[model samples]
Target: MATERPGASDGGATPQEGARTAQQIAGELRSRIDRGVYRVGQLLPTQRELGADFGVSRDSIQRAMRDLQTEGWIESRQGSGSRVIRARRIHTPKARAGQPAPISLGPLISEAFEAEEVSLDACCLTAEALTDHVGVQADRVARGEVNPRSISLRLLLPSTEPKPAFPAAADDPGDTRPYERWAAMVEFHTGRLRDRLLALQRGKFVSDVDVKVRRAPVTPTHKLYLFNGSSALHGLYVVETRAMPLSDGTEVEALDILGLQSTLFHFEKTAFERARLIHNSLVQKVK
Candidate 1:
């Protein structure tokens, strides 16, 4: 977007306020991009239109656009306003020699349990992804492939008491069938995962297996897995348009987000700025 800065005589905002405005704008726009409001390859709205819509000056819009570009969400050209480079994947960990190839969620879970005392802290829309992988770890323990003396897992899932913001009917706000289905899935998977972990204790496979779950007040825009409080794997939830089947066999097109299919970017405690920020935030949230 070709945004022009407002002059001093225009009674424009101060530099600090302008920076904060730019951050807010950038955040909102990032969410929209993840939600598929602006699909890949589509050009963003012009600076003048964005300024009018957000009620900000052209300078703020420019700053926000620059942020998007730096994050690899969009690309700006001389003649082209700004095109979405990708709908997902703002960052990825760099590969290093003598290190094993990056692993998926299931293997990551198994590896985490190799320690004597295993602890996992996760925050996501649902516990489905964690549940699936924990099952894999349980299978290994059951088969004597690996065993840890203690297993402790804390899961933060969106509350069921309140209506969820996602998996809602695309056109009908009052229809809650999608939300109900999602909640049922969460309950089943979490219960099964917990059963497997607890069985290890019951069968004397391990001394302690403590599984705790709590409801998060907000819907998750990203999924985080903090392993042993030192390593982190983070991924975004990208919006998807697909048809879903109901219990009665009726199908409906729904707007939803996928967690497992998205790439899980790996990070160490001190690797990069974004990873470090997420790591610290999750550590504080769990505390």
Candidate 2:
């Protein structure tokens, strides 16, 4: 038999194999982080401990840990072991700072108007972008020319107190059906004011009209209204209350307007009309 070389018994698994092993270890650690097993700011196991756990050499574990640190999954500080740093949340173009931040409609509208050919996807994207600025766009297109100053808005409000009790089925002669009773109450309370309220809830209403309904989770009993203009958006809030013997009825607790415009450039007339109508109907009933 021929004499074998000193290291020939072991197969030729080159240095590249070691690097791959480090990559694999790094991947496993990443999975653990993703699963929340090692949360942000939590220290990871020592290289020796990790190497023992993964059945790899300490060198391999060190390489892997270094890779993770470089990738921002973890950080290493002086005298401190490797600890996870939570990945920063992604920011969209529309995110703003401060409470009641005014949404900017310029960039989106400009892009839409400047595009050479607007496709269906472009229109959809435009609508979505507009939603980020205002709740929704109007269904009907404003006639004449697109005037940034022509936009108008109104707000709808819901009654706070429970509607007054109606006559019982036995007492009423015309109709006592549950549906009829409910319809009557809704009509009495919301009928006259319904159109205006609807206009305000939906971002688009009649030509030059836009509405905004803000429901705050902190104050669940009331919904805020915003009537938008070309350069400004106004606000009003209505609250529910117990009925007293003599009351002036529900009052507008707050009213104010801030600068903000809707993204209306290059929008289809049909889409504008539809969006306005849908928004109106939905906002009318929420409060």
Candidate 3:
């Protein structure tokens, strides 16, 4: 697989709207990369093409591309356009039984949504990536591509009131900027996720919808996602000390984790564990 060049970016050509567009386009592209829709070493559509497809300006595309590059997802060149660098990742010690292909969270989530009753439980620091993937499935339900009678979600998040172990000031731990920034992200992404799920119920598409998000007082070192009480995806967070830019145009030394890059381990109730119950919340008992 090809690797992105070190310290390569779009030369900071992001326009005034770059801030908003960075999240908008980068998220969509990120989801695609995660799902393996765009494989490693494959050149993504040119900025002109992506702008037309996504109905955004070329400047916004540039900004989004830069964000992707910074995240180690893609790399861009002067004329060759941007290409995916790290999409699918492999880890050892555990593998899905009888499955030849690598498991993707996208497909598993899609499968759950296809059932008459869909249940999801996730424990994570933020719902940013989950929100992105769920957005795609919601669009499917809206378009009548797949119809499910109900949807249920239980999301466990860290309490916003406490200062987290991550996204903290590296030089001075007392700086509250990181905590404030983390709070804003939790509000924005989780709120959006809740609203999107409820909208399906209001539209009368899904006959029933239950979304319960709880705040856990402690920070979790690993993220866990349970799909329909049958399978679980777990990934451990790796913390790093880096410089984070604040909204006020100043940089701060910070400690953070890149959740997207973490390797996930898949476990099944029947194949992986012998325990009688896989998830206590839903009471998924193994046969």
Candidate 4:
């Protein structure tokens, strides 16, 4: 009587069942890899050995190895047997230090503002930067800095308000009143947004803002704003652009800020949640 191999089962199957047998063997091998029974860079058993173990033909074992190779789980060398490859790491986006700060557009809109000759793209991008800035500021606060409060917010429909237009497209055009009104709006919204985000960051309360931009562009632009007490945090904002686009050339711009406001708010409440989680995990490991 011969000794049974590692993958051998009691029942004897026919050659017609070879494909199924090979698949079963492959699955077992994969399971071993997943469970860490077979470590990366470890050579798998020879075809003959695996065939004997699984009570299958050497040809069947070869087929399974080919499958594993095609799937990128293992690589084969002429002199060296098949070796397992470490799995690829997942890709994630994160904030970088010493880079241009994120921008937010939440504060740029006047209650009843207007503009002309401004490219839709410029307006949209600016709005997005504002919201992104808010997120950045919130991150700073989380690190125990003297940063403004910021929150992740979504703008809902009907409550959406359009951005008022600016007089002209001059780069640093010095019209005081429009600029002042614009600055005031930015301050008001930034302060509100920042406070809400800080509350969420400090675990004080869970709050959200819904910003709706109407008549501006087909696509809605989003922004994050920071508030320091009653004042808006200077130069800290973040913006995210929405995917859906309204019909082209629509003249209306609207923004409606909405969401839950309370200490129960968690940082995991926004798009940056996963990145934040990864960053926290890495930091913990370093410590």
Per-model CA lDDT versus the true structure: 0.77, 0.40, 0.75, 0.42
Residues 67-133, candidate 2: write the lDDT tens digits.
Answer: 8766656667566677665322111133245534322232233223222221111111012222322
In model 4, what is the error at residue 172, expressed in angstroms?
52
* CA error at residue 32 for candidate 3, angstroms: 9.8
Q: TM-score each candidate.
A: 0.59, 0.29, 0.63, 0.28
Candidate 3 regions off by >4 Å? 1-102, 271-287
Better of 1 and 2 by TM-score: 1
Tens digits of lDDT, candidate 3, 1-287: 11222222654334444566557788888889878788655789988898777766677778788887755566576876776655643233345687433244555676678888889999998887677667667866886968989899999999875666877888887898977888888899889889988999999989999999999778779888899888888888878887877889988888887675567777777743545343552564432
Tens digits of per-residue lDDT, candidate 4, 122-226, equal 122123233333443343344453322223333221111333333112333443343333435545554554564546545642233233342332222322232
Output the TM-score of candidate 4.
0.28
Best by lDDT: 1
Cα shift from native, residue 157, model 3 (Å): 0.6
Cand. 2 TM to true fold:
0.29
Ranking by TM-score: 3, 1, 2, 4
In model 1, what lDDT does residue 52 have? 88
